[model samples]
Target: MTSLRHNMAYLLTITILIVSVGRLGDTTGRRRLLLIGILLFTLACILCGLAPTLWTLIAARALQGLGAAIMMALTMAFVGETVPRARIGSAMGLLGTMSAIGTALGPSLGGALITGFGWPAIFLVNAPLGVLTFALAYRNLPADSSGEKTDRAGFDIAGTLLLALTLSAYALAMTIGHGRFGPLNVALLLAAAVGTGLFVFVEARTASPLIRLAAFRNPVMSASLAMNALVSTVMMATLVVAPFYLSRALGLDQALVGIVMSIGPVISTLSGVPAGRLVDRLGAPFVIIVGLAAMAAGSIALTVFPGIAGYVAAIAILTPGYQLFQAANNTTVMMDVRPQQRGVISGMLNLSRNLGLITGASVMGAVFALASAASDIAMARPEAVASGMRTTFAVAAALIAAALAIAAQTYRRRRAADPR
Candidate 1:
C-alpha cells in the first residue's frame, strides 16, 4: 500500500500540477505562481513529515508533487523570460548542475537520516531547506506574468483524464509485474493499453490539447522531448538498480554503495556548466547528439562490465553525458517555443521525463524479479544480477539510439524548413 501510494501519488500529482500550471500560465503571473508553489511544496513536505496515517502521507506527497510541478514549470519559463536567448543554454546548464547536486545528495542524506533517526527523518529534513527556499523566493522572485493575450482555449479535460488513466495503469502494471499484486496484474496491463489508446484519440481531436500536438510539428522540439524520455528512463533505471547490485552482488556495505552511487551525480554536476557553454556556442542539436552518444556509450559499457570496478567506471562515463543531455535538452525545448507558451512547453518536457522515470522503474523492477526467481541470485552475487542490469542498460541504449535518429531527422527537417 505504501509503495502504491508513493508511486501513484507522486506520478498523478506531478502530472496534474504540470497541466494545471500550464493552464494557469496565462492567468497567474509566473513569479507569483512560483512563490506560491514554493510555499505549498514546503507545507506539503511538513505535512508528509507529520502525517501518521498512510492515506495522509499519500495526500501530503500529492500536494508536494503539485508544488514541485508549479515551481519547475515556472522556473523554465522564468529563465526563458528573463535570460537572454544567447545565454539561456549556460543558465540551463547551471540549473542542471544544481539539480545533479541535489539528486546526488538526496540518497546519502536520506540514508543518513534514516540510519541516525528513522524513516520519518528523511521527510523531516526537508523543512529547513523548504524554509530557506521559500525565503529566497519571496525576496528575489519578481511579479511578472505580463505577456501577449491569453490563450482562451478551454481546458483539455479529456486529455487530462486520459493522461491520468495512462499513468495510473502503467504504475499498476509495474507494481503487479514486480509481484506486488497477484491476479490483477494482467488486468492492469490491459488497462494501460486502453488508457494509452484513449490518450492518443483524445490528443488527436482536442482543439486545445493539454499537450500541444502542433508544437510537435517542430521536429526539434519533438525529437528533444522524445530523446529526453528515453535518456531519462535509462538514467533512472541505472540509479534504481545500481545500489542493489553493489550491496548484494559486490558484497559492498550499504555505506560504500551509497558513496559509489554518489559518483555519477558528482561527475554530472561538474560536467553541466561546460556542457551549457558548449550549447551556447554550438547549438542545442549538436550538444544533444554528442550528449546522447556519450550516454549510449556509457550504458553499453555498463552492460559489458557489471562488476564494482566496471560500475564505477560506468558512472564516470555516464554522469557527464547525462548532465550534458539534460542541460542541452532544456535549452533546446525552451528555445523551440515562444515566451508566452514556455510554461506549457516546460510542463510537457517535465511530464515526458517523469513518465520515463516511472516506466523505467516499473519495467526494470519486473526484470529484476524475473531474473531473481529464475536463479539463486541474492544481492551478494553481483554478476548474477548483472544479467538483469545488462538487459536494462541495453534496452536503454536502444531507446537512446532511437532518440538520436529522431533528433537527426528533426535537424534535417528544420534546416529544410528555414535556411536561416
Candidate 2:
C-alpha cells in the first residue's frame, strides 16, 4: 500500500501539474524552468531515498512528479522552438526514440539496482544524471527572452486549481471504481463534475486561461487528441495485461516474463527514429494509418495465440506501431497549433495520454473482472484471469479498428477537399 501510494502520487501529480507548468514554461522561459525543475527533481529524489515514513516518500514523489512534468512539457515545447519547422518531425522522432530507450531500460535497471544496492540506489543514480542534464541545458540550450515579461491575462489561479481538482477527481473515480462502487467513488465523480463546471466558468472569464477553449475547434486537431487518447488506451492495456498473461497463463518466471515484456519497448526504441523519419517523409496521416493497422493486427494476434512466441511477436509488431503513431501524433499536434501555443498544446498532449491511462486502468480492470466472472475457467483462478486477458485483447483490437476507421475517414476527407 505504501509503494502504491508513492507510485500513485507520482502518476496523479504528473497529469495535474503538466498543463499549468507547461504554460508557465512558455511565459517564464523554458531554460530557467527546466533548470529549476531538475534541481527540484534531484532534491526530491534524495528526499525520497532518505524519507523516514511512507507519507514523506509520497510527498517527495509528488514533488518529483511536478519536476518531471515541468521538464516533459518544456522539452517538447523546447524542441519545437529549437528545430526547423520542416524537420520537427524528425527531431521529435529522435526524442521519442530516446524516450523509448529510457522506458525500456528503467524497469530492468531499477530492478537490478534494488536487488544489488538497495532501493536508495534508484533515486541516488538520478542525482548525477540530473546534474549533467542541468549542465547541458545551461550551457547549450538557447536563451529565452520571455523571462522578464508575463502573460497579460496573468496566471489563473482559481482556474488552475479547479482544473486540477477536476483531473484529480476523475483519476480517483477511476481508481476507486476498480474494486467497488462506494460513497467515496461517487463523491469523487461528483467533485469531477463540479470541478469541470467551475473550470469552464473560470476559463471563460480568465484572461490567460490554462487551456484555450478555441483549441478544440479544428477538426483534425480534435480528432488527433481523441486518437491519442484511444491509442494510449490500447498501449496501457497491453502493458497492464500482457505481463499477467505471460507470467501466470504461460507459466513463465519473472525473468522470462520480463524478457518477453521488453520486446515492445525494445522495438519501439529501434523503430522510433525511423518512424519519425517516415512521418517527415510520408506525412503523419499516412504513417498513422499504417500504425493503427499494425496495432490492431497485434492485438488480434494476441487474442488468437497468447503463447510465448505469439506474445513476443505481438509486442514486436505493436511496438513500432506505437512508436509510429506517437511520434507522428506529436508532430501533427505541434504542427496544428501556433508557435506561441506550443507549451500548452504539449501539456494537452500529455494530459490526453494520462487520461487514457487512467481510463484504460478502470475500463480494462472492469472488463477483465467481468470476463473472469463469466468464464468457464472458474473465478479467482489463474485460468480465469487469463480468460479475461483474452477478452480484453479482443476488445482492444476492436477499439483500435474503430480508431483506424476514424483516422481513415478523416484523412480521406482532408485529401478529397485538398487534393494534396
Candidate 3:
C-alpha cells in the first residue's frame, strides 16, 4: 500500500503538470501532447514492469505519473471545452463513475494478477489497455483549434519546486516513520512545515502561479477545494487503517480481509451513476453536501463500533457518499473555472486531493505509532490496535464533518452569487 501510494503521489503530480501544460499548448497541439502523454505512460508501464529494484520502480513510477497527469489535465480541459454546460454535469458524473470503477477494480485485479503471476503482471496489464486507449483517443479526439499558445511565462518553477519539496518531504516522513528515526523524524517534520510555508508564500507572489491563487476569490472554488481535501483525507485514512483492523484486530484471514474490503468499492460503483444523475437535477452543491454527510455518518459509525461487521456496514454506507462527492465535486470545480484554465484548475484539484491523501496517511500512521507505543502490540494484543484504529476513525469523522460544513457553505454562497 505504501509503495502504491508513493507511486500514485508522483503519478498524480506529473499527470497534473503535463495536462496543464498541454492545455496551454497551441490548441492544435493539445491533442498531439495528449497522444504523446499516452504513449509515454504506456512506455512507463513497461519500464515499471521490468524494473529491477525498488529505486528503479520508483523512477518508472515517476515517469508514469507524469504521463497520467498530462492525460488527466488535458482530458478535463477538453471535456470543459467540448461539452455543453448543460450536459457537463452528466458528463462529469459519467467520468466520475468510470474513475470509481477503475479504482474499484484495480485492487481485485492487481491481487488476482499477483496471485496468479507476479508483481510484474500488475503493471504489464496496463500495456494492452494503454495501447487500446491510445488507438481510440487518436482516432476519435478532434484536433484542438483554440489557437492558444503554450504560456511560456506562466510556468512557475519556484512554486512547483516548493510544492514538490513539500510533498516529497511529507512522503519521506511517512515512508520512513516506521523505522527508528527518533529525533530525525522531528527534523523532517519541521522541514516539511517550513517547505509548506514557503510554498504558500511563493504561490502568493508568483506572477503566473502554477496554481492560480486568484481562483480562491471564488468562494465556491475555495470551499470546494477545502472540502475536497478533507474528504480525501478521511477517505484515505479509512482505506489505510480498515484492512489492518480487519486482518489484525478481527483475526480475519487475508481472503476474508479482501472480501470485506471489496464492500466499499462495490458500493461506490453502484452509487456513482445514480449520484451523477442526481447532481444534474439538483446541482453539484446539493449532491456534495449529501455525500459529505453520508461519509461523516459512516466514519462516525466505524469509530463507534470497531467491529468487523460494523466496519463492513460503515464502508457500505460511506462508499456511495464518497462516489457522489467525487462526481459532484468534479463537475463543480470544472464548471466553475473558465475553459482555458481548466487544465491548471484540474491539476490544482488533483494536487489537493493527493496532498490530502499523503497527509491523512502520515497522520494515521502517527496515530498508530502512538497507540502502539501506549500498549505493546504483542502483550496487549489486538484490542490496543483496535483502540488506535478507533481514534483514527474518530479523527477522520471529525474532519469529514468539517468538510460537510464547508460544502454547505460553498453551496449557499454559489446560490447567492448566481441567483438565477
Badly placed stretches (over 4 Å) of model 2 are 147-153, 177-179, 374-382
TM-score, candidate 3, is 0.88
- TM-score (all chains, Cα) for each model: 0.89, 0.94, 0.88
Minimal lDDT window, size 10, model 1: 372-381
Question: How do these models rank on TM-score, best leading?
Answer: 2, 1, 3
Candidate that would win on lDDT: 2
Q: How many pairs of residues collide in model 1?
A: 5
Off by over 4 Å in 3: 1-29, 52-54, 178-183, 192-207, 369-380
Worst 10 residues of 3 by lDDT: 19-28
| Model 2: per-residue Cα lDDT over 156-206, one tens digit each | 778788888899998989887464568998899899999888888888888
lDDT of 3 by residue, 183-220 (tens): 76777778889997887788888777766667878877
lDDT agreement of model 3 with the native: 0.75
Using lDDT as the yardstick, the better of models 2 and 3 is 2
What CA RMSD would you report for each candidate?
A: 2.8, 2.2, 3.1
Local distance difference test, per candidate?
0.77, 0.83, 0.75
Tens-digit lDDT string for candidate 1 (1-420):
686766578667886558558656644567777888888888888888888899999998898888888988888887887788999899999999889889888877877898999887887788898889888877876666445335545667778777777776666666554535556877877888998788878888887776766776776777777888888778878877787777876778977987888888888888889989999999887787888888888888988875778988977888888877887889988875776677788888888887788667777656665664544445335556666677767777888888878777877876788788
